[model samples]
Target: MALVKVFSGSEILAQSLKVRIEAAGVNVIVKNNIQSSNMAGFGSLGQAVEVFIEDKDKEKAAQAIEDFKMGN
Candidate 1:
């Protein structure tokens, strides 16, 4: 299955999103994991973490994230 980027944020936030999406039965992968370790620059502690899921599950994954953000 093809993967599509759904969100991007800090490592912690990406991991949190991953857990939530997976809990909803949607598989997720985190990209740029190495970038999360480098805090050399100012305001760069979070780094760039990309979250991806199957293309077919894009809508559901997005809704899950929205619901999560809405505290649903």
Candidate 2:
């Protein structure tokens, strides 16, 4: 199995946060997407998204994400 980077989860902050972070430089292949969990118009959050990346670039990938969040 490949590495799974949790960009977002059951929350918005976590969802976009992850994307902005990785998008800094590393390749962001949105594996899963954040969407409505169930059939309803009440709850909405990071449904589920997956992105693939080189194992070696994991560190850089993580940093890019952090920087993106910190607005660096």
| lDDT, candidates in the order shown | 0.78, 0.55
- Top model number, TM-score: 1
For model 1, residues 9-28, the per-residue Cα lDDT tens digits are 77777888888999889988
Writing each residue's lDDT as its tens digit, candidate 2 over 1-72 gives 355563544444555655664566655545444343344445444446454565666777776666755767
The best candidate by lDDT is 1
Look at candidate 1 and tell me the lDDT of residue 1: 88
The alpha-carbon lDDT assigned to residue 9 of candidate 1 equals: 77
RMSD of each: 3.6, 4.8
The count of residue-pair clashes in candidate 1 stands at 0
TM-score against native, each model: 0.69, 0.41
